[model samples]
Target: MRRLKAESIFTPKGNSVNEKMYVPRSELETAFIKALRKPKHIIVHGESGCGKTWLYKKILAERKIKYEVLNAATVNTAGSISNAIRALTARLTPFETKSYEERKGATASVGVAKGDLQHTRKYDALPLEPYLELIRILYRNAGANDSFLVIENLEHIVKDEKLVRELSSILMYLDDSEYAKYKIRIILVGTTSNLRDYFSKIDSSQTIINRTQEIPEVSVLLSADAKALVKRGFFDLLKAKCLVDPAKGFDEGYLLNAISWFSANVPQYIHELCLELALEIEANNYIITNELYTQCLRNWVQEALVSENTRMEAHLNSKATKHARRNQVIFTIGLISSNEFSAQEVEDSLRNRFPDSTYGKTLNIPAILNELASGNSPLIRKTPKGTRFRFLDPKIKIMARWILVKDEGKDTITVKKFDESIKF
Candidate 1:
């Protein structure tokens, strides 16, 4: 049998897994594929690391669909949207065939820069006429071709009313104009809860909202899927040279279980943890045991804590009292066995942990919980039980524990291990 390669097994962070390694997401993939076959616009919204972008790219490429990606992260005004549409037109249509002068003239009226067509100047109002004409021309030539325009990082401009209105107009045009006959789907990708939030502030968003076919939020993988992911990366994909000899008493079972537990079925976390373990194995001459995996996990957790602490201190500019109070809540929450906890439970824990502190004496547990659960980058989420809340990602829980341990000056933190019986 051919030996596997390490890189093939472990995908680096922020990179998409290839089709061979791509795990089908069952119902979600089915629904998304079915939607792709129709004419309605698509909104693929989910948690940040839930593989929304990867899944979309993989499916589109595997199906051999023609699509153009417009990153909305840089889009803050109407002109940027126009430029994005123009750029998409240039790629999908025969507009590039026109002479440089003709292309300049074609874009000049739309506020696009003559010297650099890709860079557009801000417009006081959306130049709808040029975009309509361009879309009409493109669709006319498409001739049964299935193409899509994907706007990624759309959450970036959701708060900008002008951009939101312009986007609504664009969607409305696509849905209402003669171009709708071509059945070109406009895919909006983001980490927002729903597309409705993008147009919530706009009065004319009803038309766009009515035209949308939303894909439900992408979620973490099931245990079986996550196990298969790990198994494929380790036993199947890790090169023979990277594995321990049969004589070595490495406990593969324990390591795999630990990975699945630590990752909490999040694909990105799984890849990251597995890659770190693989590097450790390679460096240590393929000698891996339960003890080594535990040590590795501890080190990884500490490293993550340092990084997260620096980020929070720099970016989260809260008053000293509020900052300390939030940190206390986070650390207290970490000590609990379950991810989900009640405001009362958290309050009690805080009081027990820091009895003399102001946070323990007069903290508004409910308010703090709400803020943490609903903030821009939410660390926790309100559960269906009303007052109960759970960490949005398992990694946050892990980091909180690390923070707790370091603050307490502990030599080691004892993490409650996941049940080992669960397998792929």
Candidate 2:
């Protein structure tokens, strides 16, 4: 059997849109493609690591549909967007001679595209019309049908009301009859699922929301997809076999479950974990073992968890009392099966993981949960109902599993033998 390099299969932080190990999500693909077929703009939003950027880039490239990507974080205003495009296309204005023809003539050709070529001295103030028309003229002049302006990392600007409102107006303006023929569209990509809510507080939001097609939240991979990714990476591409059973009866196998469980089935996390595992594999034997998996956890933590571990220490071993048991509770909570969990879930987890628990009997689960969420550096926050809580950051959950601390002495704590914890 032919084999390929691990870098090609596992590209967590690179531009590997057409990786052989990619597991397709048909529903998302259908919705996005349909939006591309129509005149409406597109909004693709989900959790931070849910692959929002990758999803659109992959689809756009596959169909030979051209797209220009701009980060909302950098271009936070309407003027900045216009400026960024000017820089991106290497100043689309004419090279020399009469510049107005290249600017206005190019605009006139593209469905009544408008721009104020007049000098600032000619008007009381420089016209804002040019800011909006630059993109229209640039895309129109490029002459690619079915093109896209993908504005990504919108989370950077979601909190600023003025920026959100500015973006809303821009979206509405693009839906004008003047630009109907170009068939160009906007694909807004962001991490927050409630991106539309940020837009709603502005004026005429209903019209703004209606113009953009909402694809279903790009979410974590399902069980089958998660398993497929691991199998293809380890078995199909690398031709490396594992020492453990594939664990095929249920949703995931032993190897896939271990990788998916800690990564929370996030595509980027899965890629990172598998990539590290691939690097650690012995070339001569080509056999993956439990000890290798353990080593990979340490390797991954070193690479990705410096900040997460520091956050864990902020609330760990709360000095109020040694019997507080806050650290253990946090670790147990990391093993949670869902995003939102109750005090009962933590108690249940403690019972399962450490049935011979002296602490479980006298534990005030809810009280401890409250403590973690209420401090100078709170790690979690309660929902509206106040009965359940979740980590303020999702990465905290993964850190829960592999919390590494050199000191387990009188005043400190950490998870030792994390490889064995998977079995328990």
Candidate 3:
């Protein structure tokens, strides 16, 4: 009997945790819960928009654990971090106890020099012992279940040695405790999957990584999970919204395959595409059709993917190079699932996708790749050593899928409407 609006059940950009729509990443949740219970500092890393923030927030809330999240991007500077810590654990108390007699009468002012009577403000510049205060406050704040300081977006400062060192210094201090048992811990969340490598590049990197425990990368959801989200939201929740049996003029069997393919296994993109499709049902007599889905894809591209599409168009073949098949070759590259690929792999993909097209046989793939990566409004970039390349953004491939289609009749590729690309 559970029910909700499409927008409420599906959120792409919103920060609110939709428990009704949440599909628990079981393995990830289990590992994270284990990490939380352990004594070591924790690091959770994955590609951007892979649900890192929501997962931890959901787990912490369920366990009723006390925690605070500070975005590293906002507190990029070391001084800002120190200021935040200072507010929590550092204080200055007056130590002036010296007795002084006030000039009550002319007798007290008997000094020959009147200037001598004015007593300048004085205090013993006492020792800081900031670490001691930090420990005291941290332990006090660490209630029955202890406390967690989750630093989200750790990737923002990993490149700066000073910030990383300042941060590691605190981590080292936490380990120096002798007798007292303090439960306060730190959890670092980031978008980069290679977080440890980023730290290892720094001098004395072991000092920080040694104190942290990193579970498996929270990469894109498994194909099954992605489909579950679609089924739960599109088929169940949308039905509850009084739009049961919404599929129209389309073979509903393919809906799951369509979403999983177009979403590229990214949960957020899946949510976004599903939300748009659900809206079509609400607006069009509670009936969703292939044409509606197709139009929704274009609307999504125009709204959020304008930049990627523009970049793609900028990297296309010129008018005089029409027969060169640049667009067709790039679409074949988009068919590649791996983010990092070499020119040879791309050429092979070209042959596989377009066996009839002679362009694959003669195209100078490496040179074309270099130009695409280095040209104006570059579509991709090469690694520092130039061994491999990847799309400048993952969204680029998604945009290409929606915008370009291969014309089997002519063995050519052209920008076309979504209906043309729909296999059904």
Candidate 4:
């Protein structure tokens, strides 16, 4: 009799995993290896959840190097930069005997001047000169032959021209500093929007940008990679089955069938979804079937829809007052709803719906275009002519359709009419 196959494996939750179950991007590995050999500043820019952080961590671990990581999402603001610097300084200070003695003296000296070291811990902001001095002192005290400053989510602070200039100066200073002759490195991580915006505004920032290494483009998984992912999931389920019972049930046929239907070679999405289906199958007694896997897919789609709704709600609330034009609203909605149109097509679509609206203005179009392309929208992506937009997320597309049908009753307004309102 053919044995009953157990379901898929458990998907790892909340960004915790060492071994990557997804297809490894060879370009990423190559870039990482080069950076490891020579301490070089790097910028790993990509869409969110495209494995930026994971790739960074993996490469660092594989090389067995000492480094520090500062998550910009947790602390990135005008004042947070000082805190980030201090936090990084604290970590870079090693625990060796010499470092301890050096830090002890530096602490004592500051304490003597300020009355107490504790009072200095809370700061509004550290002046640029003093901040640089502190970094130099810390490096000396720690006896670090080489050091690396890993800054993530730099866009959070890069928006301010002054701040961007200062950051540029700081990186340049450190890169050229006599102490860095031993090969200190700086690694900046952010989405592509961050880099684009930063570069457009700050001339000095180009100095820093030129020195950084970039991760290569990621393509869809190969046939071998897809098979490997399927195999990993199947084997995980088998291990689980052994623990539950010296299983008489659970066979390769059932596992292969499930893989064929739901697996798309998107590792991050596939690994987790497979694991979820596996758990349900185990609970129902190792009888994995296509129907149960289908249920899991349905659940995944629903979850994705809910997440997209939350994003759209936040986006709408923030920009409703700022971007009130009907055409602009339609453009944004189209951006989230479909990824197939060119800029001309979007303009055509808007013109058809609102022919009188001043949809021809370049300035207004670019602003909306920037917002969508900046990774802030998470749903819309820009093509070449700034007129085209694609929905990056499928769930956002579904939500956009719902919104369009619901708002069909409103008086249709065109770009020309919108321009008329602005006329004083």
- Please list the C-alpha lDDT of all candidates, in the order they appear: 0.65, 0.70, 0.70, 0.51
TM-score of each: 0.68, 0.73, 0.74, 0.58
lDDT (Cα, tens digit) per residue for candidate 2, span 293-333: 76786677667756666667777765444343677688678
- Top-scoring candidate (TM-score): 3
Across 283-321, the per-residue lDDT of candidate 3 in tens digits comes to 676566667777876666566676676677777766344
By summed lDDT, the worst window of 10 consecutive residues in model 4 runs over 415-424
Backbone clashes counted, model 3: 0
- Give the Cα error of residue 58 in candidate 2, in Å: 2.7
Off by over 4 Å in 2: 76-82, 89-134, 141-144, 244-253, 282-285, 317-333, 336-393, 404-424
Give Cα distance to truth, residue 125, candidate 3, Å.
11
Clashing pairs in 1: none
lDDT of 4 by residue, 1-424 (tens): 2333432133333354446354477877797778656545667765444466677777776655545666666454436565667655556654422311112223445436643333223233433443464456545644664555577766565566665665666566545666465455667776543363465467765666666655563323444565566666555524433222225332554444334333333345555566666667667565555556557655654564556655555444223333345335543454332234554555555545544444564435445544655655555665423456655643454444333322343424222211111110
Better of 1 and 3 by lDDT: 3
| Candidate 3 to truth, TM | 0.74
Q: Whole-model lDDT, candidate 2? A: 0.70
**Candidates ranked, most accurate by TM-score first:** 3, 2, 1, 4
Task: Select the stronger candidate by lDDT from 1 and 4.
Answer: 1
Cα lDDT tens digits for candidate 1, 1-424: 4645556666745455566567788778888898897767898977566688788888888887766677886565435687767666666665344422212223344555554334434434434465565555545565567777789988776767777887887888665647676656688988666567557577876767787889867776777788888777766666423333355434555566667666666677777777777777775655565556666676665554444554333323243342366767776786665546899999888777665564325689899888877746777776533657877656776555443332343222222212221121
